[model samples]
Target: MTESSLFKRTAAELAEAVAAGEVSAVEVTGAHLDRIAAVDDAETGVHAFLHVNREQALAAAGEVDAKRAAGEQLGPLAGVPLALKDVITTADMPTTAGSKILEGWQPPYDATITRRMREAGIIILGKTNMDEFAMGSSTENSAFGPTRNPWDLDRIPGGSGGGSSAALASFQAPLAIGTDTGGSIRQPAAVTGTVGVKPTYGGVSRYGLIACASSLDQAGPCARTVLDAALLHSVIGGYDPLDATSIQQPVPDVVAAARRGADGDLSGMRIGVVKELGGEGYQAGVERRFGEAVEVLGKLGAEVVEVSCPHFDYALPAYYLILPSEVSSNLARFDAMRYGLRVGDDGSRSAEEVMNATRGAGFGAEAKRRIILGTYALSSGYYDAYYGQAQKVRTLVTRDFEAAFEQVDVLVSPTTPTTAFPIGEKVDDPLAMYKNDLCTIPSNLAGNASASFPCGLAEEDGMPVGLHVMAPVLADDRLYRIGAALEQALVSEWGGPLLDKVPELETA
Candidate 1:
């Protein structure tokens, strides 16, 4: 492959070249870094990266090259360049989780995924932007600024994980890590024309990831190709002693399943369509594209059946309550007493005042809003009416997923209800903006495995809409298999990657 083209090659292709000694690890790392440098402008502005650790990256590349020269065997992902979301801790780079309160704070330890990537010889490119503490549905809430969509800079890249998706779509990196609390990975991937996966709750270790909503948070891989996601997932997922919630089982062979589906025709794969996920609330273009996706899956020998999760109607409200309640609790540790920037601590002031002053100054408005909303919900008189009831609703929503998965090998829906909206459109309306995650939030709530891949461009708007494939909890490989099958079928049918439709970037 051409030098200019190698950086854009699929993860599998890159792995082959690395294994065969056709490309040096340092060369590949440099190429990706050059690409990142090439288009990092206000116009092409894929503001995906927060703090890039070029020194560490180059150092890692050198070690990989030395290993190759010594004839030492390497893992499948050796020499790959990967992006880390700010939410995930890294020893070399400061982990901000896209909030000013935690700015310039580097952890003494690496996140489990970060540590795993290093062990597999993958170079860390940088930390990506996200919603402040992953609280918003779009990256617009990022304290560092929003990551513009790779497809159309005028619009948003999906939130929380938007930075990772933008980086992959822009060819800045082949593989990246992103978190999904409420469609942060999948929705952003959909808008940017890349692949994003949310493995089952305990599939990927959450040891060092900053908590947004503990029960709902998960870290997963994001990439341009399904197999690339699988590779990264394999590297990062497994049990960790640090996270009590981590399930210590071997993560199924996600890459193997993806590769198999890449070649295997989608025969006998039963797909259940969630009636609640796509319909009246969906944009016409989204619906049209989803319909085409259904047709494509059907033609590929997949049996498409309609399934209903009636409790889905309550999902949005329930998630808002539960998430804020958790956030209110989780963020309490960031008071002036410890960590990051502390603004207001005077010797005369009481502890509570210092906390109030510190939090009031450090937190952004959206974060403050959620904290207040959560406090109100968790208040003694309202706890039963709001937070407690939301927990019950979560159980119902999860049961619906269990029942649906029993009926089909995988469940399908539009990754988002609409294509990417203009940057500021929903920034002011939290509720309306939160609705963008309607199709994706349930998966996080239920702790199931889900993958989002581009289906086709939206007909009315010409923007891309994604098709989501979700599987049972701990059956992450199933999502990858189904996603890879659909990805290969659609890419082959369309004759190439979906970003071919994206407007040309006005590189600096």
Candidate 2:
């Protein structure tokens, strides 16, 4: 392949080519670096990355090339370059979590996934932008700036992990790591014409991953194709002793499942259409595209039925309460006395004063809003009325999932209520922005495996719409199976990946 075209290859293909000696690891890594320079930093750039580890990436690529030359066995994703969300700690790079408070803070050690990727020979392109403390639905809350959708520069890429998704959409990187706390990973993929998975809670380790909501946050793969995502997923997923919540099970054979799904057969699979997740608030085009995808699944021989999870109606409110409650506790560690940003520390003020001043200046509005809301919810008199009640509601949601899964192998819905909305269209309206995750939060609340796959473009605006799939915990492979089946069907219809329809970015 020509150097310029290397950026267009999927991670799996690139890895195979490198392993077969068709292209050196350095060449593949360089092609991606060159692509980032040309599109990410251009005048009309996607602004997806917060930092680009060019030198480190090439050095890692060189190491992979040396290993290949020595006839050593390499991991399946060896030599593939990946964009990482800023929330994952890297010893060599700053992990700001898109917040000014932690700006320039270099982690003392790498995140578990970061170390795993390095051991597997995956080159780290750099840290991508995100919502401040992973708090908002739109990337607009990022302290640096919002990442633009590659499909439509004026529109928003789905929240918190938008930078990672945008990078994939623009071909800046073939694979990425994104954390999903209330659809941060899947929702971004939904908007960017990409694939994103939220592995079952505890499916992937949380060690060194900066917390959004400890119970809700999960790190997962992002890619342009479901098979590519499954390949990447196998690399960074598994048990980790360092994370107290890590599952003690082995990672599922998602790659094999994806390959099986690529044959486009879902015979004997029972799929459920989430009755509560669509309709009233959904966009006409989004619902239309989602319905079409469901029909395609039926054609693939999957038994389709409408299933209702009634408690889902309360998920949005319950999630907000629960997430903020955890955010309040997790963010407390960032006091001025600690390692992050400090303020009012000239020896004349008390530690409390310094912490107050530091947080006042350092935290963005959304973070502060959540902190306050959470504090209030957990306060003396209101705990039962808010936080405790939300927990009960959460239990109900999980039970709903249990009941639904009893009758179906997996459930499906429109990933979001609508396609990508224009940037700034809902930033000022927090409720509007929060609603973007409406269709995705139930899976997180229930700690089930979920994913977003590019179904097709919405007819009204020609923007990509995602089909959300949810499976029981530890059944993450099921997500890949369904995503791959739909991806194959959709790619066949579109004559290529949906991202092929994206307008080319201006070269630097």
User: Judged by lDDT, which candidate is best?
Assistant: 2
Cα lDDT computed for each candidate against the true fold? 0.87, 0.93
Error at 135, model 1, angstroms: 1.1
For model 1 the local lDDT of residue 191 reads 86
User: For model 1, how many clashes?
Assistant: 1
Candidate 1 lDDT over residue span 271-298, tens digit each? 9999888768799988888888888878
What stretches of model 1 exceed 4 Å from their correct place?
A: 42-44
Estimate the Cα RMSD of every predicted model relative to the unseen true structure: 1.4, 0.9
Worst 10 residues of 2 by lDDT: 36-45
Candidate 2 lDDT over 1-508, as tens digits, reads 8976799999989999999999999999999999888888623689999999999999999999999999999999999999999999999999999999999999999999999999999999999999998888779999998899999899988889999999999999999999999999999999998999999999999999999999999999999998899988888889999999999999889999899999999999999998999888899999999999999999999999999999999999999999999999999999987599998899999999999999999999999989999999999899999999999999999999999999999999999999999888988788888999998999899999999999888889999999999999999999999999988998899898898899988888
TM-score of each: 0.97, 0.99
lDDT of 1: 0.87
**How well does candidate 1 match the true structure in TM-score terms?**
0.97
